[model samples]
Target: MARHTAFAAICVGICAAGATLGGCDRPAETAAPADVFLANVAEYCGKAFSGRVVANEPPADADPFADKNLVMHVRGCEQPSRELRIPFHVGDDRSRTWILSRTDSGLRLKHDHRHEDGSEDKVTIYGGDTVDSGSATRQEFPVDRESVALFQREGLKASVENTWAMEIHPGNIFAYELTRPGGRKFRVEFDLTEATELPPPPWGHE
Candidate 1:
């Protein structure tokens, strides 16, 4: 009887300590980086931001984006955490939409290019999947096999090895970047401090 009573008292003491220290309950698991990243970008749903080309190495003599207004509309967020569609507008051209979605392994990024008539471009839907667990504010995607085959078929062999990355600093800046071998670097940064007028939907989305 004495041993049982002592054991009961010890258990009671342990329980009291657990109650105070929260050690008895299992700790909540932290979200994976990919999930956190998706959630981070989803916060901008229904907003629009203006961007400018910040880096363009091997500058072209006739830059397509030069002096052109650039806008990114974060829309199509019915399933914000699962998928997001951001339309990238360059002046009068409204043919590009960036699709970000969560995959079983990690995340995926795809480009949807369309013609003015709403037809899919020949080299459309080409992008990549995240190869690792990027941070909550940034992710890198290497060109996938499917994209490589499409690029090869389209005679865009140089793009087969492309790597695309995105960075989001809440209330500060959102950046889109692309890099490849041979010193190719292109980046566009959007000011997240100011929300701009939402642009029209990309081709075929309207």
Candidate 2:
């Protein structure tokens, strides 16, 4: 009976040791860089900021932002879903929503464009996921496979190599940037120090 008791004790010790070893071998998961950027953006929830096209002459096409009203409303923060749906108003069009989501690998930024009747545009949902964990205030997302395919289908071959970036300067500026290798660099910065009234619900959001 004493020998049997000793054997049982040894088995329990072995199991505990194995469990400890397994735990030590596993690395801990950390918050993604995109999530950090998203948190920074969330700080402006329920606020509206107006901006203008900083670039004198945007390349690749004629500037559609000339003398147009531009407003961005950060509203409806969904923490549980890890998504921040920020509506971007260009001129009289309120049909654009920038969807930021935290994925397993990184954060994804999708541009959701809708018509006046809430119908999705054929070229909507074209955005990319962060390829790396950038700084807390900034994250860059290169063209993802899905976005590339969409561009190809839409005959937008020039946009296949595009990359988008968002930067938050905390009380200074919040800028959205787009670059395509050596193609073009477009940026628009909102005034963080002076927030306007929240805009109405995006075209289809209501």
Candidate 3:
């Protein structure tokens, strides 16, 4: 009888130990999905970047060089999922919105650009590519042909042909590169040490 009691106690202790270890591992397994999504968004939020713009050909009577400075913010995100709304301002007149999410098809990116007073720019929906390679997340977008033609008609052809690239480092560094028609390119790199959520844009609230 005593031998049987001792064996039962040993089994109970072993089971308890296993339960403790299993409990400890649960959080990690459940949290991994959200962690990965937030990590990518945190990489570029609240950062400032600077770069230049070169045109394929100088306008007949305009300057041939332009420079840009931009600040990026991760406005808000849906938890337990990979949906994010990122807003950015470039120089003084151009503001943009980027919607990012993880889809079965891969990471998806959509862009919307607006003028200083919140009017839609010549191009509204610009398509882009995104990749989350273990170390960093990167995106590249080219101006759409329809938007390019609109810009051309509006006398802003030089700006329409620029291709944009953005990269977010795991350490919260944001970098951008812009290339114009004639292979002229500009690059910017910045870090986001402070992240604070701001009020949503008017349209967003609606």
Q: Which candidate comes out best when scored by lDDT?
A: 1
Candidate 1, residues 1-206, lDDT tens digits: the string is: 43233223333443454422133232212446675576667777899999999999889899999999999989997765567899999999999999999787688999999999999999999999998988878999999999999999989989998999999877789999999999999999999999999888899899
| Model 3 stretches with alpha carbons more than 4 Å out | 1-38, 42-69, 91-94, 130-135, 141-163, 194-206
**Which residue pairs clash within candidate 3?**
none
Task: Give a tens-digit lDDT track for model 2, residues 35-83.
Answer: 4466567777789999977753245356677778899888867551366
Q: Pick the candidate with the highest TM-score.
A: 1
Backbone steric clashes in candidate 3, count: 0
- RMSD of model 1, in Å? 12.5
CA lDDT of each prediction against the hidden true structure:
0.83, 0.74, 0.50
Candidate 2 TM-score versus the reference: 0.80
Better candidate number, 1 or 2, judged by lDDT: 1
Q: TM-score each candidate.
A: 0.86, 0.80, 0.51
TM-score of candidate 3 relative to the true fold: 0.51
